[model samples]
Target: MTSPLSSSPAWKALLAHRDALAGATAADHWQASPERGAAFTFPCAGLVVDFSKQPVAPETLALLCALARERQVPESIEKLFTGEPVNVTEGRPALHMALRGDEHAKVDGVDIRVEIQREREHFRAFVEAVRDGRWKGATGKAISAVVAIGIGGSASGPQLVLRALAPDHEGPQVRFAANIDPAELDQALAGLDPATTLLVVVSKTFTTEETMANALAARAWLEAALGPAALAHHVVAATSRPDRAIAWGLPECNVFGFAEWIGGRFSLWSSAGMPIALGLGMAAFDHLLAGAHAADLEFRSTPLERNVPALMALIGLWNRDALGAPHHVMLPYAARLEGLVLYLQQLEMESNGKRVTTTGEPLDRPTVPAIWGAPGTTGQHSFHQWLHQGTEAFACDFIVVAKAMGSDPDRHARLLAHALAQSEAFMDGLDVPDAHKACPGGRATTTIVLPSLDAMHLGALIALYEHKVYAQACLWGINAFDQFGVELGKTLAGRILPAVRGENAALTPATHHLLGIIHKLAQSD
Candidate 1:
């Protein structure tokens, strides 16, 4: 029986080929072809993707494509677009695409597109009311600030949107609080009047520990400034379980219900994205969806050979498996993309960093490289040292926007120059005389060029990575939608909470000792 994937003929061929390219350097490949830059770069949906500096030869790409064919990548793409229940463990189709207008998906023998539109209309009404002062605070004041309270995708998507698109859009003073730490909520709520503040609590289950904790705290803070009656007008929830949200002391009208197929990380496209509409205008949110839909079409219609998302997945797989790089870094030259790395950490790692296959068999290979990074030229000062001279080499993606944030052409030109120079430096290093200054630059890097940073561009950028993660899971034979790995930590934290409160709950010796010290410190305080 074929147990591990390594036993497959295609997997074996890729493995054999991995060893043959062991001695080659990225510099050698960069010099191997005159058309390397033109041949390796591809454009789709107004974004340019350059994979020329990925430490792979044309032969390696051909072999990777052959492996993709052998692994049925085209079939996987069809399965995803056709609304198959690819997320087998949950017995549900990951129809987040339906929220973006995938016409062919049906949930429970009923068309979900109509339901998605209904939900969107329902939430859009609420957003319009808040934006227009029709939905006033309990004290009859129009809200000027909106504090989005959610953990993970719920907060990250909205925060990233507000930060990236803040220059172009004029909306509410949007802020996000995700950590259970009191300081985080304290800072988010600091100096804001509760009468002019609107709270959006997002959770799929209405029961996420961190989310609910912050939600309750924010409610209490708002109640202290206003009254208990203020919660009806001051707070709203975006969740699948609207009944539970209403029961948790929100008005029924305040709860925006979504379908169950929306995974937390992918829910940004669903009603969980209501905060995006609230933070930006409904028009910006609509543009975000339109941009994502365009990418969805690009991924759906383009063949694997020319598909941008497909090529990203295949190249990522080659870097992770064949080239043996364990870390991938994101370096966006645009300051607006500051949160892009954190967004991708949860998007890629939470989705594909799995140990077992879909059928519950152990995987013989690493699933995902550790996804982490910072915005550049900032990262150039911080982690670029490690990227250039560290003993371990990593895969990097340099995201550069052609247009600057403001009208300062000189600063933007310098930023663009530094971005290109870094890529070149990474590809072709200086063979200097001084040993301390010598930099061995054989790192694999990809340059993704965006015309500008906007809601539409952000939408396409996010969708590209989302599909890439899903395709990587398909290639690895793992369930990308299910994230059972995060449960154990949550469970342990639940049991440990009582210990922190000075209760005699069960605990390991190490934990008990730690709790003792914690209690002693609290007593001193």
Candidate 2:
């Protein structure tokens, strides 16, 4: 039960190099040093990670690789793919990947794959029925729009994929609402006929605060317009808690259950992906899985130095720890990938943003950077100025889909040009004599080029980021499988509800002070 960091020689070496590395500031020296680049570059999933710009040496990487090996990183990965209970705290296997393929792979002689495949098949049939106009509303109109209701992983993952693959899409107009704010639900439901709109409730537990609230609101809206029979046409629930969904009046046939093995953030391949499958189709969904499987195979079999996910993780570690960078930006050049940054934020930050290791030991260093970004061209107009001239140095990942799925060749060329220009500008920043205008020429960045914006490539890209998060967690000695950090605020909110309703006793002094301001504001309003 000892934390991986305790026994890692690489962690020790990294700690030892702290003083020397702090004194080093020249990016050129690191890049020119053959020894440095040789150790830094690693390939996996047919992608090359050039970490030569990073400050770590070859010996450091070898030691880190050794640390990973010693910690049974390979075994952990195999356990994940083969469906072992690697999510030890939850007593479940993390088998989101199995949702896309054969579930025959076993762990402890149990086959969870069959359950995942069954859900996928059910989703596929639903998608087909809707697309073919066989699934009609109470008014006998074909479904024309979809309102996906959920928060966090349920909303972010499918929303990202749908937006990214918009060009290849030929289906119903899809909208997602994740915020708990009443405005978000109101806006998503506005101007759409309740009868022709499909409301997909995507909470795994079927009882998420935001999702359930929105579901209730949606039900009120639909019943107001089309009556109780509208519920039969408008609702579909994605949850492990099928009984809860059924209790809420969703038909058992419309309730898709994914296994506990699929964490919310990684559940896109499971029934949580009903929105994605509905927006696209069975073929597209399958392609997305196939792409991820390709990346998975490559990540498992490749050498450490050539492993893409490994190299990405190590380079990220170097940036966060060695250079003391606090933020990591992901700028996808394609407009289609606008939501990708949000998706990655959850995938990377939620998974590894831990204060303690798996064994409950305090961490010696910061874990996980603040991940944020937007699509380029648009972001260039807004935030590129800060990125180039700001005091803070944030590492960036520039993602480019190699070929545009759009029909306009000219537009595609312009997109690619912007992507290349941004990376180049970041790496080779121009010098300005004006003190306020000067650019820091040594900003670090990594470029990820997907072959195309097809479902398969998008799937691969997502899986690549997923594996990178996992590997980094392994190296950092944290549990990538759990997210206990999100619970504190929720617990506090629940406790405050009765107080807000004035049903409880008078608040404590600190709480009274806040309530005084609230009462004053209510009078002013």
RMSD of each: 1.6, 2.8
lDDT at 499 for candidate 2?
A: 74
Runs off by more than 4 Å, candidate 1: 1-3
Colliding pairs, model 2: 42-305, 43-306, 43-307, 43-308, 44-308, 103-113
Off by over 4 Å in 2: 1-7, 15-60, 405-411, 431-434, 505-508
| lDDT tens digits, residue span 1-525, model 2 | 236464566667766665655544335545557365445555444444556544455655675676677667777777778777777666777777776655377656877666556776788889999988999998999998999999999999999888887765678888888898999988998899887999999998887898999889988988998999789788999998999999999889989888777799998888888888888877898888988887888777777766788778877887787678899998888888888988888899899999887777898778899999888789998888999889897898887776766789898899889887877677667777887767776677877776777888788888889998988887777778888778887877777767776667545789868977886888794
Candidate that would win on TM-score: 1
Q: Least lDDT summed over 10 consecutive residues: which range in candidate 1? A: 1-10
Give one digit per residue, the lDDT tens place, for model 1 in 1-525. Answer: 114668768778877877887757768876667678887888877899999888777777787778777777788877877778888888877878767765767667777777777788888898898888888998899988999899999888777777888885566788889999989999999999999999999999999999999999999999998989999989999999998998989988888888888888888887788768877888999888888888888988897777899889988988887777899999989887888888899999999989988888999888899999888888888888888888875898999898878789999999999999999999887789997898887778999998988888888899999999988888888889988889999999999988787676999999999888878888894
lDDT value, residue 275 of candidate 2 = 82
Q: Per-prediction TM-score, please?
A: 0.97, 0.91
Q: Return the top candidate by lDDT.
A: 1
